[model samples]
Target: MFNTPGNSKGDFLEQTKAAREERALEKRRDAAAALIQANVRGWLGRLKFSQTILNDIDEIIPDVLDDTDKLHYKPATEIYHQALKFLFVWKKERDKERFAKLCRYLVASLDSDCPNIVMLVYL
Candidate 1:
């Protein structure tokens, strides 16, 4: 029980049994703590800024893909087209308003002549 040497065999056996029980209880406590953490908001407040980051990524992807699509290589253009298709659907489902805003922003700048219409048509 105490830090001193045990005089009785029964005392030593009891201490070992208690130690094992303590270890098992500690493991249970840790598992419960992790489950509680999974239910909590998070240290960083739900990471709401992640939505903005997603929007930012959405805003730039089309221009990058368009540039790649211009490169004339068959495989590269096909892959770029595939990525564009995926992003378009994802943005629509996740942040449709932001998608519309970005589409307008891109279009508003290029609405002058038929030349720009060609670009819009490609998109």
Candidate 2:
């Protein structure tokens, strides 16, 4: 019978855990960047977003995700609402036509997807 050293086993486990966590974090970062890019690009092309504000939002998003407090359920909800308000106002003031259409579509879509709407509304 052979026995492995406890310290070595613990070290291996720690390294594995760290690697998994790093990979998960990278995946999250990539997803966040992609989402922000798509939203910003779409709104910009439609003239619904300002380049400067979009840049600011893009900068803040990663920091928001990185901060543990912002990543929590309640804080995240607050952040989401704040972001939504900012974007809504930005769009409405910049592009009234698109803003009205989007708001109408959103309301109708929300009515159709009640559960998601409820979650978002509560958030």
State, as a TM-score between 0 and 1, how close model 1 is to the true structure: 0.41
Off by over 4 Å in 1: 1-8, 31-46, 54-91, 112-123
For residues 93-122, write the lDDT of model 2, one tens digit per residue: 554544453344333333332343322334
Q: What C-alpha lDDT do the candidate models reach, one value each?
A: 0.52, 0.53
Query: What's the TM-score of every candidate structure?
Result: 0.41, 0.37
Using alpha carbons, what is the TM-score of model 2? Answer: 0.37
lDDT of 1 by residue, 27-60 (tens): 9999999988876757445355454455454544
